[model samples]
Target chain A: MVPNREPVTGRRVQFMISCLCDAFFDDAARAAMDCLERAGCAVTCPSDQTCCGQPAYTSGDWDAYRQVVRHVAHVFHGDEPIVVASGSCATAMFHEAPIAFEGQADLPEIRRLASRTWELTDFLVNGLGVRAWSGRLPARIAVHDGCHTRGTPTIRAVRALLGGIDGLEVLAFPDQDQCCGFGGVFSISHPHISAAMGRQKVDNVRSVSPDFVVSADLSCLMHQQGIAGRQNREYPVRYVAQVLRDAAGGPA
Target chain B: MSRQALDAFAAGIESEVLEAIEIGARSGVDKRLATLTEDYADADALRRLAGQVRQHTLDHLDEYLASAEERLTSHGAQVHFAASPDRALEMILDIVRASGTRVITKSKSMASEELDLTRRLTEEGFEPVETDLGEFVVQLDGDRPSHIVKPIIHKNRRDVARSFERCGLGDYDDDPETITRRARAYMRDKFLDARVTMTGANFISAESGRVAVVTNEGNARFGLAAADVHIVLAGIDKVIPRDRDLALLLSLLIRSATGQRITSYVELVAGPRLADRPSGPREMHVIFLDANRSSVVGSDMAPILRCIRCGACMNACPVYRLSSGHAYRGVYPGPMGAVLGPLLAGNEGFAAVADLARASTFCGACRDVCPVDIPIPDLLARLRARSVREGVILARAGVPSMAGYLLLARHPRLWRLAMGLGRVLDWLPLRRLPLASIRAWFDSRTLPRWRGAQFRKDVKRGRREQEDG
Candidate 1:
């Protein structure tokens, strides 16, 4: 009963649809599924998913992080690799999950899960070597490199995939790696600094003068979009999956 | 000075600092943190070591204080323990009274700022001069420091030149060396003629009972050596376990602060005068001021005592770079200052600077650059929570508006409708808000636009269609 399953063309793969994407941003997850399946890959959505424990780890709450990591590791315990849609979630799995179970006997399982985890773009570019999408969209797009993605190797892969799309003019932002300042609850807790950092990011996007700002993480996009609406500004925001899907003549 | 005067000075500094950070960001100076963090091993190890040392010093502060005093007295230096700021001031006044001293020169000391010592000295008919170049500029201009390390960082060379001319120091030139030499000539006579010299201790080694002073300029050495009486003022927390601890701190201090291996001079003074030395102070007095630091000691906030006053956090702070130190309206400024000010002053209003705590991007740059590895952001969060609990926020209208917004945000249906309407209204010309009303929002950048489709709605529709298929 896999939803949005086109025939698996190239290879069979598994994915963990992040809770945010499953419940709130289902369209983006579906768009990504359509793109991946059309490009010949079987996708699986794990049902026992909750959160990546980023919220807990970031807050310095080690106890909450321990519980979340234990649950996530057990749910995705198979030998086959698991892919995630959100850059932030994937980053948490790879970076923080191992650190959470540092001295426990279950450390090996946590380490294995960390190694096997990948963001969607990482899976596509590194796992499948599908650099160019067989789809096309024409628009001037500004790409925001999520803070977790900037220093990692996967950002280059995402850039490579975007570059391979014909007629897609990818504009560069000044401080592209700077956090959108939407650090989970950070925005609400310290609104002034969060707003200041967001304004800086928005200004960077304006300088590039793109039709829409795109990123892999929907949380950042949501924050930037909300600020844009409240302030009555005019540059739209979207996820890279939606942009890539639209370019492929699929639903945005 | 009155609180009103201080507030005006702080507001002016805040504006200047904000302008500077914006300029730095535009010029791309903020990108250095990434490479800098990579160069240092995870500072967690150093942070833990510093924390443990500070806790030990603070828990047994009385014992350490007695030990430090006994050792200093044995080495021919007098020890004075000031239980309060008034007692500290009276002790210095008593020395002035006994010696009939009318002129004094000082090296940069936050303790002097804490006691408002200069103002008190002047009121009592004694002239106190600031000999540090940055301190001299601020003294000449009659302005408080805009930063702890770079007191006049907000002031351009032209401002210094004008200040110099106003001081009757002859014509003003904006060159750095020229300004320095001008201050030097003015302070040289004061240094030589000074009846007493006062300085702040960087670190007091309990093992050796030697006070360590690290300075770029030789003002501390000159002031202490040339004066007839030398006085050292320090907080109780400034005492560390041993010289090795001082060495570790000194190594981290210079490198983290100005990116230097060490300052020009590292002076370790154990007594009044050295027999082998050609010249030195005749009488040495050490004042260990407790004030409110005892309250911080052995408490959750004690880790802040690990600070060596290196000003590394100030240099790395984007907010400090923008607002400078004056905006904080405290003796200290920057990330460390934001935490230290309220605790020392014993006034909740001083905690208003925690408003600036909301100014950081939580980029972790300050914590990363911190040689001692103070969990600055975590401390900031605690301060913000404290501010909310005290009801000081009600005094500011901004907090209520934020609270209202948060209430609306909690309701999903209302939030979505408001966002939908906001998207439509944003396209209308009348909907554009005044830049000043939302100046804080648009100061560095414009707002992004609301794209037409609701992401949640689109996602739900996609899910429903797939389910039907």
Candidate 2:
């Protein structure tokens, strides 16, 4: 693999492998780690890392949110920056965490954590300064803008990171800002709508006719992948991290 | 409607919504939502103007409302502020009592639903009739509206036939056109005889003190024209800054609502009657209801005040397409309803209305379509976050599984062990213990199979291999 830039060293970083990545998409997570470490940052996965309380929070369970936020805040109480592999989780932390602890004493810590949290690509480009990759993997890819990333303030950082990758042709689809309809447990409870939404996303991806449909959130990717598989569609759903790792001439 | 009735109706509608989603999967929801998004985006400039007008009116609501009242009175109109639903009902009761109104004809108005106006009017010994075909069907069935615009969307033709039979319409054909024609014929007589007419304002122009009501059927115009007294009930948010602003809002309203460029009739009632017009309501009363809107406006949730009630968000929302409006169990349904319902109703129970806000994929389509550009997803997230902070969410869920998982997640050894167990289970299919409740989950949709060991382990293995080499 050709070296693009000297890997930065000695920065403390933690990985938040979102629940979907923990249970599925192991390769993408592995790819994310490889890319992060290669960029010269010391990374550790917090054993206590679970969900970002998004499911409960979105479902309107405030009490459940506190327990989850306290648990996550206590687990990653150290001074190091928390880097999340999933855009949705990072968004939860950055935007929802503080809101989750509004009047509590832990509000300050939650706010601090929110400010420190970053999506993987955001951490790579903005935090680690790994703007370009030297490795080449010729593939036409369509980028699916995850809802949390697009609806929140994190869009620019994610887009810039994806744009800097080499040997990757990014195809833009119309209405890219639309949701894939996997809204966490919503897909499970309201499957018909969720599936319909997923199918819509699959169609958009198919319309682009790219080799892979890529997104920052594995949860969204997994949902689209399920739709593709069920419909027997040929397009693959991939994580942006895995694509970047592959383009860097790293592991699969 | 009683609690039991509402629950049954909501459940029935929700099931239908699920079925629609299944059909939509094959027919396409993405294309539909995309088409709507494009249409809404096209109306962005007009929506912005409407939003600005709404903002200006709201900023000086007191001044405009007073000015509107005075000007309306000068034109032979009476204005009343309904502090609450009961108070509004009482005001209506007083008016009807004096006029000896035996039959009252109402145009489509959600505020009337909130006040249970029909029930109240019936109790006060006056017959209340819904003139709009959709609302008339819902009224005949003794059912609440399932949708704001398409109030009877939940009712198939068969259901309408059943309702018509129940209402003693006598063996009518189940065709939609036939049913509509029957209702129109029945309502035509009531429209002429009814002493009191009740209607909702689409936009209350604070500039000209005119109430602009847009209707496809022209029933509102007919009701206002024929009745001895016309009562216009609206929330404070309906006020716009100027007459010109109505044009912008009307454009967005028509296109987003029914995909039409404009409704058949746009009735601008400056007051009760025009001197040139021989036949118009002799008396006009505008009732501005403030219920819980003041609280919403004072809080960070103020942007909800900018809504134009175009129902574009409902049509564009994937969840609403599946669950329909009844599932929301509020006067409002869909994206805008999910955000505003809880706030307006002030019911914590309404907050649990089927993860309504979370129903969106955060596609921003509703926000894009919003005439006033209310950041619907952002508002939803904020509300959800607030719900989490207050502990109302999990209590409503009746379990704390999420908290338990968070507890397990915080311990390093426990988390690692859990991950290791997940890996083992992945290898041995039989060992899988429904991790993430895939079975219960997959009953409705396909479950994502475990891909074996996590990405962290593979990454560590790769690094170790490199070091050994």
lDDT of each: 0.68, 0.71
The estimated TM-scores of all candidates read 0.70, 0.78
lDDT string, candidate 1, A1-252, tens digits:
001112223466666666456445667777777766766676655544456766655544445566777777776777665677888788778866665566778888788788777777777776666765645777899988776564355677677777766678888778675677766544543445556567777888889899888788877776676666666787577777777778774211
Candidate 2 per-residue lDDT, tens place, A195-251, comes to 667777788778979988888888888778767766666757778778777776532
True contacts kept of each: 0.04, 0.45
Worst 10 residues of 1 chain A by lDDT: A1-10
- Using DockQ, give the best candidate's number: 2
Q: How accurate is candidate 2 locally (lDDT)?
A: 0.71
Name the TM-score of candidate 1: 0.70
Per-chain TM-score (chain B), model 1: 0.82
lDDT of 2 by residue, B1-469 (tens): 1111222333455455455433433233334334446666644566666677777667777787777777777777788988788898889888877777799999999888879888778887888999888888877877788667777666567778888877887685798787878888899999988999999998887777889888889899889878888888898777776788776777667666666667898888878666765667888888988878877775677888888776767766766765667767678887888888777766545445534555555666677667677878767877765655555542233122465565555565666667667655434544244443443234334446665336656656766897999
Q: Highest TM-score: give the candidate number.
A: 2
